[model samples]
Target: MTLTQSRRSGGRAARHALRSAPLAENVRPVRGGMTGGTLKALSDDEVLRIHKAALTVLDEIGLADAPPSGIEIMVNAGARLGDDGRLRFSPALVEDMLGKAARNITLYGREPAHDLNLSENRVHYGTAGAAVNMVDAEGRNYRHSTLQDLYDAARIADRLDNIHFLQRPMVARDLPDNLELDLNTLYACGTGTTKHIGTSITEPANAQACLDLAYAMAGGEDAFRARPFVSNSNCFVVPPLKFATESCQVMEACIRGGMPVLLLSAGMAGATAPATLAGAVVQAVAECLAGIVYVNAIQPGHPAIFGTWPFVVDLRTGAMSIGSGEQALLTAGCAQMHQFYGLPGGAAAGASDSKLPDMQAGWEQMCSNVMAGLSGLNMVYEAAGMHASLLGFCHESLILGDDIIGQALRCLKGIEVTDETLAIEAMREVCMGGPGHYLGVGETLARMETDYVYPFHGDRTSPKEWEENDKPDLIAGARARKEAILAMPCRAALNPALDREIRARFPIKL
Candidate 1:
């Protein structure tokens, strides 16, 4: 292109950016409903093969490390403690525990609007990570995350229509102690949003403290238990058949305390787990199966998410390649396994390797998100706002990803082909009786709200109009959105008296 053309394009972009950002009209939140079993990546035979293999691994290679009490509990529940000091689950034992597992589960929110029903192939998108660094949108750099930053993330998520639930996305680096960290983490998230919150704890004792805090904020014990707004995202297992003793203890404590649990098994492939995708999945399944037995033994049919989050690694560099195509396939295939067992499950997707939310991050997040949704994943954690391969979190990225997830959910909604939707009558009227186009038709006006998804920051101006208005930067738009949300008074704040009471009771860092 000549310099004149380039100059003209630049002039148009500037003019477009100067105008007020266009907001879509009649846009509403997309609710997750039963969506899949349509796109089956694994055949029935393949699914059965993986199921059998997982059971075999559990029966033969029984988990080597369970807290002694955990072993006794499982043993009492019909699991065999081999002479080798490992607890082996027989196929019958696995089947029995599977029968005892909760089939339909609901992750409750402080508010009724944010409750997530986890039955069948229903999909819900949310944040999930422990990124130490928070992305600075204006400075274009990374900084240590703090309590305020964590609160801001939850607040930002609270406003986003597509980000259904808010998990503890970033770590509070400023807090000095683990207990303080866990308590404040809950404090920040609990106050920041009324949506279902997911958080991790470092010790078993912290469970009661967190529960106490949640109960106080939620009004009382019965009220909190009735709508337990938080669930422990506990990494109960470390790797190939070894229970994380402390996290297991936390799980047991939380379950007994009437809190739901996310039985997370995050094994890194080629390092902590097998390099082959099939092998890693088999191992993850076996580990989660053991987790079920442990949970059921503690309290039969307790609410637990079947979390099998095995990450991919770059073989040559021995580093995580969370954005790779292989990672997308891993999550999709894992969702298939979740369906095989008729269990509500969650797995990681939409985390990007890029440090910045550029073109690379956009594609990386979208690929896994779309696939995970299509694969009938019940819970899609880290579906938005994650960067640097889960090492960093960005508010702007989170806002932009709301758009990405909106589009992905549209894909999941797919096509509804019924007599009314087929539009045979409308089409005949438009083509034969009226205009050739369906431009100003009744059907078009009626389906606009139900059929279409409008993006928040996406620009739809043509080159001429763009030049006439001003060129807008997508990142800047997201920054404006973040600022707008943060500027608002906390919409999900706790009662003033209760907030002060809890702060007095605990070492409230925030």
Candidate 2:
């Protein structure tokens, strides 16, 4: 062949080789636990002011409605119970507990590869919520979410590269009994994905049963404790300085049973919390600081997430405006508090008020997710597939959210300015001697996969190509990807014998 023909053939072969190459874990464009925090929602002085305000709230206002067990525990650990039945904390005691709280903790997945390291400004996105309904894309209607839907969501999340972990997102409304519901929720989520699983326990009595299931799945108690694959997403506190009675007890049990806890303080602004943005943030921070004190008192250095999930409400309607810009500020501001304490923390983001995954949903989800990542929120819960102000979970949306998160993470990864990345030498080569453009250059080919994040379902075809391919729909693309994933057998990590044993022991609805 002539020289030009040979170069064309060689270029085609090189391109094919690059396409077939495997991406090493270290060089992938984005993955879990990317460091962010470039976006400071609160200035340094502002962060300090918020800290002092939260401490004052804890010291003076205090929280009420602590359970008997909690009251005894804290009373023994420097907290005082008032005659009016409020639990008061001192600044000294709060600081001591903060020092003892775990930092830079690793949340392990069943398959060690999926473990997430939460440290300084490290970000990880995952699914979460207790939505009671599921949006059926094909039927185009809302229906009660069952255990099947929860399991299916986990199945989809398992294959998505951007979703770091799996939290029980939807409630299994089909089961009426609380114990049955909690057990099935754990079983379904644990078995559905090998990634670390999280769920809430209704009653303290069921904590051991859930731990027993974890132990059985992990081969023994020691094995499970060494790297606990499940975490308890405990809503330990109610808004405005009050402890959730039963939820606190559940948190105590889980901590003793070797389960990491997410100290979730979900207060709605203009409703359960203060209407002012700074005031809402103050309440969330104070409530979570109390949780930190509680967890450290129970067991010092216990792995607990400072989850300040303060939500927003439309002032006129008093309904939660989760998709609004105010909600993004609440979440981002809370992340600053987590950084202030130097503790691993989480906050809600990527939820939408829109009912479906339309243009509205896209803008809303992207807004908070990008802000949350930029603020360096450790665990961005409900970062995918939530709608109707968190009342509904959409599978197609969850599928599409994977693509959305991939792009968001790319932003968090930010621009690396190394000698190689500067591309000075490559630019000189192209400008000085080679082709007018850099499209077919070696530097361009080598950096293509590592320098950018391409969407799995996002349409990027030219008009002619789009027309040739029948003008594929976005939601249709997501639905097709969802079906392709679910078409395979279940991806549960539990072996058949252990799975059968757990099934026989508990009322596992899935």
Candidate 3:
């Protein structure tokens, strides 16, 4: 398999596409180079207003349910206990802590090519969820997700060019033990792909065990620290402004254990947060800002991604409208707030509430995916391979999402109207001095691979040509492609000794 392909271990058909498929570099958008934010969902003044409202929430309303040590950490970091005993922060305190937080973070992969620089509106899309069900696209049914499902998803994500990172997208429902599930999730993801992975720990001890496994893989603690491939996706807050005590403990341990953290504040709008989109954005921003203060208080300048993932709810039905227009606005607005602070941040995008990967999924996933990338969000989670309003994951849908995200990034890339690109000379050559067509021109051929992004499974044949080719089906194509990827031998793997060591150290169900 190519270095860019997601390498799966031990199988046939693993190398089937290696010789036939185009290189991932031929089409993948340049990292840290896309600039799509040509539209604004909220104006500068409106953004500032929301910012102040978030500050007011932290300044007056404060937050509840901080663990004893967490309370101490914040109290020492310019926070005060209010009359109601919740930790409160002044505007001055919030601003001061913002400066101490890391402005740029490099989420590294096992390979250098996969490293992502989270700065300057650089957008990266990846997987994130804890979907308990796996939607069988072929059978049109749902079943509990398993460890094998997670590994296969990782392998598929590894091969997808637009999928920038791999977070734990589905839960291993077969494993009932919390600690075992956590460790195996880490093991499965780490072995399944070399890309940067984001996952959560159910408890602090589980996080330590995962770290030990990582240290072994990297050869030492400092080695893992220097290029940490795994990050803790910690939901540090339960919305309406309260700390999740156990998750906070997991965050602290992961922080001290040399793992980076995505401090997630996913407030469901009209439910946990305010009903209005702006209010939801404000609440999310406040929670993440508090997260920043907490991270810096623990270790000044330590890497923390300010994750303000707020979802929209169709209050009429109270169902999460993740695929709706409101979700797009919420994602874009949250990205703007992240930009305001000049901190690396994350938000949810490209998620579909559709039960199947159909036209509905296409619109729902692309609308927010485009907006998030256009807004230049540093890290966009749940950008691929999710369905049923985040309750299920479909591999075929995830494969299709790679094509969708590529187009979204292309839009973010925008049009560069340089003298060469303006093509005045080429136009003149074709219009008057030449054959009056650009199709066969050298420039046209040269730019075909660079200027236009092609799809792995998209069908573009004419009706007659399609009939001649037996009418290629997109879902079937996705399924065939998935099978080919899973058939390949696992290229991204732990050393034999290390693999044995890890299995011996822990109960690795995989």
Candidate 4:
């Protein structure tokens, strides 16, 4: 069966399951507490307005140095481009394209039916950065990343509730080429965990390999095709500029193959792009929209995810610095634009330019991550241990990032309105001259789960008890968590033959 037919069948099954499933015990309605003031995130009207404005900006201001193919497509589709490379797109055209585009997707996991529901206000977190260096297991520091590092990262992500997907091999080990590296890494991840695995390969052969593996895992081409297990792929558009042929090809394959493509346009301010955040954002949006237009032209109903990682250049070194506050703000603002497009937004969070794990790392990661989460990005990558933008990956960072993501999830819990939350009966009982009626009430017990995200670390005991146990800091606690997870047995089972074949094909010679 074709991938489309499979998707239609799977969609029906998913709908049926959703209809029959009981209310999730963990998914409580947002209440009138911590998130009340911030509940009015973005209304439909506001979103439309911003979208209109963006269209106007694109048409009037236009962009330069955009890919020729992208420009030709846009021009042919009634968009006006100047000799100087400025393109003006009609709002109606942009809206039409958006309306025709697929807005919903289900990212498949190894467990057949296990999928990350995208379209809802559900937020998923993962680490970001182009290059990764370090991998830690238990308390031991694994100096350089290899295939083992990728497997270890997959293991860690599988156990963390906050991490909804795995993004490629954590570290690119020695493979014949980048494509082989991506395929092997993805195969490893697929065999290692049931969490949704995201594939980001630039080469077509690598992508085909990923699809073949995905088809096998899902039982058959029909079964794999029915669901979106291999549904999305990410590719980076050239920074502060345009799309390369490879990038375009990747987008085309994804769209034609019924996979969502997240087009990330990364630019550094004062260097590759305008020094101002707003200017950089404008350019990023234009660049991404160019890619979006191309995909829509190729396959009008293809899915697209808008993303950017525009950061400021360090004036002294003229290098892209992920630690800049401008980067975080750009992520938030682009998230708003993504909502305007009525598509899922992908952004970078939990990143630091710090050389090591320290206060700078903590602050940078927390601030940027929280900002993106609150801004309502659908999927924030780089959620775990990344340093110097992408040079290092610390297991401890992953643990700490999980905690930070928990807080971000808590923030998105808009407001609650259920009868149980009002606590009117409890209030009445207390008012009736009862001594601390709230102490042991059934309602209180039921509400406890909704009230807080139980931390995986930190002291919950009394002073004396705490003293008896070593007073461990956050890092120490994270170290302990990493140890515990690494000690756990692997979840996904590998076919011995396929495993052996993969190993033989890409053996590690140390």
lDDT of each: 0.88, 0.92, 0.89, 0.66
Candidate 2, lDDT over the whole model: 0.92
Give every collision pair in model 3. Answer: 8-489, 8-490, 9-490, 10-490, 12-487, 14-487, 14-488
Question: Sorted on TM-score, highest at the top, how do the candidates line up?
Answer: 2, 3, 1, 4
Candidate 4 has an lDDT of 0.66
Model 3 ranges off by over 4 Å: 1-33
TM-score of each: 0.94, 0.96, 0.94, 0.80
Top candidate when judged by lDDT against the true structure: 2
Residues 222-260 of candidate 4 have per-residue lDDT tens digits of: 776566555445554665554555666665656655556
Off by over 4 Å in 2: 1-22
What does the lDDT read for residue 318 in candidate 1? 88
The parts of candidate 1 lying over 4 Å away from their true place are 1-29
lDDT of 1 by residue, 1-510 (tens): 789989978975764563334334334324655475566767888888989999999888889878877888999999998888888999998898899999879998888878899898999899998999998867989999999999999999999878889989999999979999999999999999999999999898788898888788888888878888999999999897899998888888898888899999999889898999988888999999999999999998899999999999999998888998889888888999999899999999999999998999999999999999999899999988889888999999999999999899888888989999999999898989688888659998667656877677888878876686578889999999899999999988888888889989999988
User: Candidate 2's residue-wise lDDT over 12-121, tens digit each?
Assistant: 67865774476898999998999989998889999999999998988888999999999999989999888889999999999999999999999999999999999999
- The top-ranked prediction according to TM-score is 2
